[model samples]
Target: MTRYWVRAFLSGLALSAATAMLTVTASADKLFGAMEKAYVTNPTLNAARAGQRATDELVPQALSGWRPTISVFGEVSRTRSSKEGVPIITPDGPDVDSVAINNATSGNVSIQLSQPLFRGFGTVNQTKSAEARVDAGKQNLLATEQQVLFDVVQAYMDVYAGRQYVVLRRQDVSALEAQVKAARDRFAVGEITRTDVAQAQARLAESQSFLVNAQTDLARAVASYVQMVGQEPGKLSYPKVVSIPNSLKMALDVAGEINPQLLAQAFVEVARNSDISVAFSNLLPSADLVASAAGSDPDFAQSKDRSSAVQVGAQLTIPLYEAGAVYSQVRQAKQLASQSRIQVIEVARAVRQAVASSWNAYVGLAQIIKNTRTQVSAAQLALNGVQQEYQAGTRTTLDVLDAQRDLVQAQVLQVTAERNRVVSGYQLLAAIGHLTAVEVGLKVPIYDPDANYKRVRNKWIGTDVKTVE
Candidate 1:
């Protein structure tokens, strides 16, 4: 007997394992690859990345003005001046051919160099402005990433919801099919009327319509996910999840301080304020080393010692006056600075409002979840009692069916409540500016925006780093 029992147990285990393996295989081709698609082919997010890289060039461009510039210039030419010159003639030796056309093609080449000796503060201000813009670009990249994360989360949840609804509707259809069978069997025994079976058929048809709607929703959600992530959403098994916030005020506070969009706006204000300094710098003198070398043939027809001239010195430019264009620029810079400040204030206010709203939603949805749980429990108990009464012949068919429908609807509401609660949690975290790819368990190559800044801010000199100064 022990040997027989051992063999039966082994057989049962093998059968169970096979069934599980089949189920796993059947469900394999879906959501397991969503993150891969997101990291690889998300166009909107990639475009933002490219923008960030482009903005990083400003740092190098600003640093170039601080470095030396050198040029090796030469020219070959033949020219005749209309001005009166020494009397000349062809062979007659009079002044008839007065126009002098000296073959002035002389090799005059000198490598001249100009370096900025000093600027009031223009270089400093411009560098600061560029740095600020780089900071802003980093923030913009962060904001773009956050937006993409939200889109992925929202799309993922939508797909999960559609799938769940499909299952729920399928269950309802199955239950209706069972009811139709029971009704038909009862009618053959004369215990039920033809109307009852017809009613059951109609209910099945209604459930079929619901199935169609659920499938339609699933298709749309899948399309959106595929567009965002660059892969198709197949079958997925999403865990029943909860989003719980530890503290609303804490979340709100964190988001207001770190939110990328808010930071980006603040950086813009800083950049524009730096522009004010740049404008002020224009009012100060600019000192630059100026050098020029030229060898001119006064009379190439005669000798080379008469006309070659070379000059090398520093040029200092002092801003004296400009029909008010410089002053107008100063005013404009100040106005822009003021506008930027106002924008920061406005964006801060808007951030706070968003925080408050998300906080409220999180709290409200938590309450709804609690209430829905109670409703689901009560509905389930009521459904059990109605089924018991129906089997005992104390409840009418209509009464039993009504209870079942109510229970199903209650369960559906419970699903929606859970979904909303978790989504609200995501929204709360997102509002506080703490939404990261890691927080959502996404595996992506982390983007390092500061790396670019560090690389160019210190090393960029002149227009080209390798150019001879």
Candidate 2:
């Protein structure tokens, strides 16, 4: 009965392991799926979209300068009075004294309308500046999206490589454990010395320590994966390589034209130039057409005491002197425009540097991965040979241990090189402004930054705002 129970227990363990393997194979997470989740749910990216919507409101605010404003005013008041010892003289009678008391209620109401006729072209320049700013905000949103996706890629690769390392370390510990057992068994028969058994035990202890550290590293990587992708990581499959630019020059050219950061700064420079015009317009003349209708009742008891008036007029304002404030503002705007222009050049240079660095790292890792794979294969063959030689009594116990350690090292290097290569490929795509939802073929609804802008650009009334999910 005991022997039968032992066989049943062994079978159950095998079944459980097979089940776990099947589950992992069935639910392996792909890179694009994680990216899609991050694109839709990432807090940072959503905040950026909200900011762009706020920037879009600037356009309608600027356009308000060309619209008419209407206002209504009203008031009501009660008055009471008492008089004593008043003298009155008639045309053909003597003077007389009289006392009088009176009480009255009065009310007034007015409506005024003013429409801007001309604002020294400030309205036009302000509108242009606002639109340019909106464009810049759109580019900024794109940059944020790229960054979030790249982060997801990095976290995914780290977790994948980390899992591999943990598995390798665990295997090393198991192998060392078996070697320690075998060395003791050999020593019991006097085939190996006590020193050989001690060496095997020491190696096993060292490998167990390494396995603990590898597990800790994997836990950290899993935490980062959750933060980036907004969910706990499952079995992650290896990601395929993304497309990259053909040459360094081509990458630089592409980044110069479409890299979101550089384009955003270029738009900022345009907005700054428009700002100069807006500031200079403050020194020019402005005109407005004004109209008003007013009515008032002097006494509530008298029907004929009500009076009404209507007026229409044009107002003009010319800034002859303003204590040099407007001139100072114009100079300040010019300086800001110069600063923005310089910023555009600075951003372009930075984008070019990122592209070049990512490209080189990606290329270098590819070669390293190839070499490490060869090294792993060679080390595995050497370990196998050494173990056989030790069994045949031609090699020392230390020879087999050294060979096993070298194999593990080579395998770990290969895993790290592959992980870095995948990450650098995505990094290169991001640098060239291609690592976006639409560009990466994510099966998610691409966020249209222009949608909210269009909805609010020409809005004339109402305070309702659309909510984002």
Candidate 3:
């Protein structure tokens, strides 16, 4: 009896060791590797960065108002006409006669320059609006980066958890197969009924079905992993749960301060207010300095008859009325600005709700993890007792099967709970705006949205558009 107890203890220990081996906790490096790959290679992230670069172009467009525009234009044309009572004097005297001229060629060339001195502060406000929008774009890009990183975390956890589930189901099936063999042996010796054998077989079949489903889930997870991480998933280790704020209030505070969506919306309000200024600017006068130098030739011949002139002057235009267009635009801009302010409030409320929800999920998963672990331990102990009692003819085969089923269910719960706990932590981190490549310290080159912005922000003359990778 003592030997039997010792053997059971060793068997339980071995089973625990095997289960622990199956639970592959992915290293920090592996988690970071997936995030880094997604950061540099994910098409969604790359597209967002490209969009931010496009937003940078607005700055240069706004600055164009402060710069001089220079242009050169030329025209050559032929004239044909009949002249009446016209006389041409050639080194002698003038005569009056009926003259005809045909196909007279003339050419003119001019270079003009204009520099805007003022546009009723329209250019100033426009530049301010564009700058604000660029800031918003950067924040939006950061938000996208967080989303992509969160997705990668989820995919990694799913694949890892799915594979572990398949392993657990396989173990359950194998155990049930052994139980069926034992039941058959007992029946052959007139110790048990055929119904006992059938029960074990039924449970085995159910376990096999579960294993198949787990495999399918794993395959789907792999496909998603490939899409998000831009490559095939390898043996992923289970991720450690991310650390988050201790309470809901702390989480909300962090989110309000750093959440990219909220920040982006605030910048949008600034941009809209600048737009209102730009619209009202139309009611004021604009001033510009215009200069031009030109040469005109009456004939195609190179002679002293060519006339050239240079002119420079300032121009001021005061708008009297625009059919109510300017007034309507100003009103529209004010309304939109008001709407943007309201949107900022809406966004803040939404972010607060999100942070609260994420905090609840994180805390809930922690409790679930604890309860599932306890359930696994208790179920394992109960299954061991039931198996021993059945061997001693003190428990029915059905009771033994029930205990085993309970153990299997507990194991599945534990595995799923662990996965959910990690995912919830990652989500909480994202909700607080910390799920970024740089925040996670991924081992890859961080994309700089400002690099491309600075490159093309003041470009004077170029068609090649620079974009962030």
Pairs clashing within candidate 1: 255-432
Candidate 1 RMSD to the real structure: 12.1
Model 2 error, position 454 (Å):
1.5
> lDDT: which candidate is best?
2
Clash count for each candidate, listed in order shown: 1, 0, 3
* List of clashing residue pairs for candidate 2: none
lDDT of 3 by residue, 1-469 (tens): 9999999987975675556456645543377788888988899989998888889999999999899999999999988888877887755677677485767689999999999999999999999999999999999999999999999988998988998888998899889999999999999998889998898888889889999999999989977887798656666777666778878888888899999999999999999999998998999999999999999999776577799999999999999999999999999999999999999999999888888887887788888989998999999999999999999999888898999999989999988888888888888888889898777777788888888889988899989875544
lDDT of each: 0.74, 0.91, 0.88
Off by over 4 Å in 1: 1-41, 78-111, 177-203, 239-245, 296-308, 384-401, 438-444, 458-469
Better of 1 and 2 by lDDT: 2
Model with the higher lDDT, candidate 2 or 3: 2
TM value for model 2:
0.88
Q: Give a tens-digit lDDT track for model 1, residues 1-469.
A: 9999999987975675456445544454433256446654678877877778668888877888789888987655665446456577667667853765534444455667889988888888888899899899988887777677667667777888888888888988898788788778878998878987887788889888989998999889877876677555556655334343567677667777788778988899999988988888878899998776666554446674545557789889998887788788989999998998898888888888877887787688778878888987998899889878766768766665677677678777777876766566666666667666655555666667676556666664445421111
Candidate order by lDDT, highest to lowest? 2, 3, 1
Error of 1 at 99 (Å): 17
Model 3 regions more than 4 Å off? 1-29, 79-103, 187-195
